[model samples]
Target: MKRILAVLLVMALLMSCVSLAVAEEKKSLTVWIPQYQFSKAEDAISDQDFWDGVFDKFEEENNCEVKVEIVGWGVYGDTFFTSLLNEDGPDVVYVTDNYDLVKRDLLLGLDPYLTDEQKDNYILWSTAPENAAGEKVIVPMDDGVAIGYVNTDILAEAGYDELPLEWDAFIEAGKIIQEKTGKRAFLQNWGATSGTSALMLAFWPYYFQAGGKMLDENGQISINNEAGLKTVEFLKKLFDEGIFDEDIVTESESVDKFANGEVAYIVADLNKGNTTFTPAGVNWQYVFSLKGDAGFGARTATDSFAVNKKTLERGNDELAVKALVYITSGEVMDAFHSQIFYLPPYTKDASFVKDEALYALTSAHSDAIYVVEEFEAKKSFEDTLLANIQDMFQGNLTPQEVLDETMEYYNTQLKEE
Candidate 1:
């Protein structure tokens, strides 16, 4: 009887240990990414497998399971904000742009989570504060810039072997292309009298080209100068000349035109041609922005990822930071750059890119790629300006009217804020 009782007690202890082990195995993590990253069927499949492998590796090393949930772009921002404010939010979330996140106080400062050496490995601008708080909120995963992709073959057929250097030359070339090919010379986004992403992409290079200041140092809206007016008028002229697509007011229409071989040249993200257009058999070459009278250069927006402060408060801060590091590490960035066909933020070296075509394209235009650091400061005005410019393109408002109205509305909004 004594032996049997001892054996029963030992069995009970063994069962309790097994139960504890099962509970530990159930530990899980959740990560959120935008739907666009997984939009294509191939992208969806590859991303799932890639992330699964990454998570599995982490789990094997740390003894925890991970769950990745992709959220749609339309509702991603709102959903992420709401989730971050919740008690049971995701362990990690992808941030599109760091400046926007910092402005809204939606991101957690990652300084505590990283060692000095670890932080040093990242690009310098990635860690710089866009706000006065000096909080480095985001880690850049993948980055891309707006560039002019000209169909050299079409340009040559239109009677030009080299691209124009000045705005006048560019417009003239556009006319020649249109006259010769009976296709649009340029493609733009002109839909709805409200600035769309496509229009913003085209407008920035011109603004820089014209030597216009979009915002003041103190972050005040300030695009009412002569250069600004000239820039707007030039774009309006392009529209009046029929150099740009008639339906450019809509987002993706211009890109569609370029992809369909209906336009000789289009302002686009480099990835559009490198990945999407090339695979569809559209042969295009990248070029620097056409120089303006002031010889101003090109500028492009930067996208990044940030941590949620609320998530940090939930006791997995270290793990969350580790996950962020893993995502932004050079190895992961190279993979993302190759897969997404975007410029890598950490390294500008062509040797870093694995894709032959992409390497050559990026290398060719490397000297012209300029990072816009004032993006966070000018976010509000830039948003307003883009909408107003779109309206200008649609002829709902004249160039002057758009500029004046945008300035008035922006100043009013700033005062209210």
Candidate 2:
């Protein structure tokens, strides 16, 4: 009886040791948040500190480590995919457009974790990931509604109190700003595509306002039509008239021009522009739409919290979902909104009235899907558009030549995909 009792005690001790060993293994969830308006790492204290402090509570609650990395927009896309291919944690990525990851089947659909009741508490600027096939793979952290900021102080020089909401009047006003101030009237990102997205930061909104789209019902190339021709012609007119800064051929340069008050008109999302300018004491009136002859439209995108499939595969999906929910919840979102105006969260009712005002202006503009889930088709479509825009701007190709060449490549390549 004594020997049997001793053996039972030994088995219990062994089982307890195995349990402690398993618990000792630590798993970390890494979140990739794009750097805000500031370019230098030293200037990113608000973002880094806030996140670092917030994650401590999450780590405590989940019993897992959390890593928050601030990544630059320039190389984020390439790095995200490489990480995914390696089954890395860029596990919970917060980005401007994560549709590619969803379409590529790399992102785990979040619907199973985030319930409908959770979605009801917030107003979403975009419908849940447009083509997710019921996965709701992305949780929108903020609205990416594009708004045009008019430097009223600069426009006052031209005797306009506000930017005209009518498209033609706005153009006339921009021309006046150009003629009187000798500063460019308006600027768009003509120099570079936003990471992997071709339509993003490009003049595609103007193209969309003129009724342009990348693909048709059958995924056929469709951007070489009449509306597209009109868009290119209008672009050429802007070029000929010096509406665009010929010297500012890159996005950073163009944004710099706006930041330094060298230009009067700037078009970008609210979060991207106001966060910098408002702090600098620059005052501007935001307009959501500049109606064109084809009627007015606006563009919107979501910067969402997207999941990594590997997180779920490793059975840590609960930790990721809960952490994201906690971050987007009331007090946390209020803190986040206080620092940066990325609109509001989808799981909370927010009083970012000032931001909503700018977003409201853009509400009149229809939202279009520039990026689809099919990785190659989406990238190819946008890349062709960007390349042709560059060629047109350089005076190497006419508008028709640009569209024709772009159409050829888009059709040929998309078919192969």
Candidate 3:
């Protein structure tokens, strides 16, 4: 009986040793990236292949492997939100707004990992104050601007060689384009399918042009004021005069229309000029921003890379941050932006552009660009304002009514959240 008990104890000890070995094995860190742009052609190296080579270098340096998942926009949001409820979230992920996650304490503070010199080297833009803890939460990935695109062919047919730079002149040109070509003069996307940030990009520049500020001295929402009302009224005028496509509320095909020569102008991310227009063989040019009451107000965007707090649980927080730093380094961004023809993340990268004239034109307007503050309530405010704007476009609500309703909803949502 003693021998039997000894044999049982030995078996248990062996099992315990096996379990310990398995627990100590290095686990792969996962990364999630959304489809932000067309980085390669069908015949070119695949994104997966490019990343595999990049990760192999990282693994060699850090002594750990990485798994990357590239997701489309349609599933990116839902996948992220669902992952937040469990332990399946990525170690590093791409985010346009990290304030929401910061509020939940789900992001790792990046201040310790990044040096002061490094921070000053890149254009961090307006993301510094997004964290209540006052710690850096993101690394700016790329520079983007919401600009106007006009089909030069259509403009030539309409008797205009270049697009006007002021609001009134812009309207006059739009009317002429519609009258002469029988095509929609401009397109706006306010449909439910549009991303909230995209909706904000479509609408906020107009408010800025109307001399509006998003907040007052006390830092409360002041969007219901004169500037807000004027922006709404101007959009209403566009629909009333048949210049802005009335079908925008139901269709998110503004880019497609511009590519097919069905529309004369569109307001979209500056990258679209390369991603869609140039490839489609459409002759096009950019209008940075129309001169507005506030001197020149164009909305610019700077999405970022953030490390998830869950990475700490795996005892690989430092490794994850190192991977993030490597990806955002000037050398990597230079290569990445070159592939997509996007505005480079570093000022020095401007010299790398194939078309110096085009790059200079885009970069010259940097002073006029402003990024919307990434406040904690930004997502909610954008969603609420988008619905109200659609109602105004549908003629169910007046411009004033839209502003009033949106401000009220914003206040109530803030209180509840």
Provide the RMSD of all predictions against the true structure, rounded to 1 decimal. Answer: 3.5, 4.6, 5.1
Q: After superposition, how far is residue 88 of candidate 2 from its true place, in Å?
A: 4.0
Q: Which portions of model 1 show Cα errors greater than 4 Å?
A: 5-9, 14-28, 36-44, 97-100, 124-132, 192-196, 294-296, 339-352, 356-387, 394-396
- Writing each residue's lDDT as its tens digit, candidate 2 over 189-243 gives 6666442343554455666677766556874557788778887787777777667
User: What digit string (tens of lDDT, one per residue) describes model 1 on residues 1-417?
Assistant: 999999999999999999998886655667887643433644443565666766777777766677877677774656876786677878778865455557667677887678877877765445355434675777655446577778776888888887786888888888888899888777766553434353356676777778776657875557788778888888888888778655655645777778888778877765687556776687788775677876745665555666666665666667777877776776666665555445644633223554466556555765555555534335456567777777777768888887898788766664454
lDDT of predicted model 1: 0.68
**Least well predicted 10-residue stretch by lDDT in candidate 1:** 347-356
- What tens-digit string does per-residue lDDT give for candidate 3 at 256-335? 88898888888888778878888888998877777666666778765778888888887888888888877777666666
* lDDT minimum window of 10 residues, candidate 2: 366-375
- What stretches of model 2 exceed 4 Å from their correct place? 1-28, 37-46, 95-99, 130-133, 193-199, 219-221, 245-252, 340-342, 352-356, 359-377
Runs of candidate 3 with Cα error greater than 4 angstroms are 1-28, 37-40, 195-198, 217-220, 347-351, 413-417
lDDT of 2: 0.67
